[model samples]
Target: MSETSELLSGLALGAFRLNGQFLQIAEGLARPAGITPAWWQVLGAVLREPLPVAGIARVMGMTRQGVQRIADLLVERGLAEYRPNPAHRRAKLLQPTAAGREAIAKIAPGHQELADRLVGELGLDQARQCLEALHRLSAALDHFTDHP
Candidate 1:
């Protein structure tokens, strides 16, 4: 195989493995808080401000249908609620309820501990570099996909 082809394969494989690892860790952290990883993810997306399901899907790199299903479930479970959107009449914004914030708060200690451990293992400088490299790779892939 060509060198570039080999590098691309390696990067893809490594990312896939890392994604699985993070999901597993998220499951562990979120389980104790009475929420699944998917719930935690959707809730996290709206912690700063409410957003429509389509907006959350775009920000999360998830399918709109998938996010919509999760959002509906969150509302039913009393973790979140839909509020009127000033910009769009039909597409209401999703915001976390007080219960949702409490659940997320429950995961914070475990999240911080895991983060500290990972940073210690990788070293702060290397961790920052790894994050920057991943951001660059994601941006390049997004650009390529957009242009293509």
Candidate 2:
């Protein structure tokens, strides 16, 4: 195989491995809260501030419909609330409920501990460089549209 082909293959495999690891860790962390990893991600995004469904969808790189479904579920579960959006009358702002904050707070320490372990294994400086490279790669890939 050519060098470029090998590089692409490696990138694909690395992405799969990293995604699997992330899902595993997230599942473990979210199980106690009776939420899925995806739910945790949505809740975590709104934990800091309220955002409209479209805004959350953009931040998460998800379709607005998908985020709306998750938001509805969160609201039904008492983990989130939908408030009127002054900026857009048709859109509602999503905010985490007290329960949502508590759920995230409970899971955060374990998540941090796992991250600390990984950082320690990689050495902090090396981990930082690796993350920086990944961020650049993500930016480059973000230009591609899935259906266009």
Candidate 3:
């Protein structure tokens, strides 16, 4: 195999491993507040603005059905509520409730602690560079998928 192909394979493997590790950490950080990692993810997406399920899925790079399921659960639990969307008649926007914000706030300390530990281990500059590289890779992949 070419060197580029080998590097790509290694990058893919590392990303897959990192995804699972991050999910595990997220679960640990969120479960104490009675939300799953998926719930936390959806809530995080809408922290700034309410989004329809499709919008949330797109923003989070998740399947629409998966996000919809979680959104429904959040509404059922009173952590989120649906409101009429001015843009789309059929699709309602999911807005995080005060309770949802409080739950996420409760997890902030744990999240910040983990972030600090990772930065300490990796060194801030290295960690930032890694994040920038990963973001660029994601953008490239997204472009390819869009054009393909």
Candidate 4:
């Protein structure tokens, strides 16, 4: 294999492993709050303010249907509520409820602790560099997509 191919393969494998670890942590943290990792993500997205489904999907890098499914689940669970959108007749805006906010607030401290642990293990400077590299990679990949 060429050097570029070998490097790409290693990067792919590392990304997979890191994603697995992240999901595992998210799952564990979400379970006690009576939510799945996906639901938690939806709640986090709405924590700032109401957003259209498409907007949320774009932010989360997920399909609209996938985000809609999670939004429906959140609404059904009474964790989030949908408001009518003035600009878009069909698209409703999503916002977290008190319960949803509370759930995220509860998890924030633990999440911060986990972040601190990771930073410590990796060294703060190294972790910052890693984040910068990932951001650059994300931007490069995003350029391929039509979405902004």
Q: By TM-score, who's the top model here?
A: 1
At residue 136, candidate 1 shows an lDDT of 97
TM-score per prediction, in order, is 0.96, 0.90, 0.95, 0.92
Worst 10 residues of 1 by lDDT: 139-148
Q: Write the per-residue lDDT of candidate 4 for residues 9-109, one digit (tens) a residue.
A: 98879888988998999998888778889999888887878999999999988899999999998999899999999999899999999998888777878
Error of 4 at 131 (Å): 0.8
Predicted candidate 3 versus true structure: per-residue lDDT over 57-127, tens digit per residue: 88899999999999999999999999999999999999999999999999999999999999999998999
List the candidate numbers ranked by TM-score, top first.
1, 3, 4, 2
Compare candidates 3 and 4 on lDDT and give the better one: 3
lDDT (C-alpha, whole model) for all candidates: 0.96, 0.90, 0.95, 0.89
Pairs with steric clashes in candidate 4: none
Clashes of 3: 0
Cα RMSD (angstroms) for every candidate in the order listed? 1.0, 1.9, 1.0, 1.8
Please give the distance, in angstroms, between residue 110's alpha carbon in candidate 3 and its true position after superposition. 0.5
lDDT agreement of model 3 with the native: 0.95
Candidate 3, superposed: residue stretches over 4 Å from native? none
Q: Give the per-residue lDDT digits (tens) of candidate 1, residues 1-148.
A: 9999999999999999999999999999999999999999999999999999999998888899999999999999999999999999999999999999999999999999999999999999999999999999999898876688
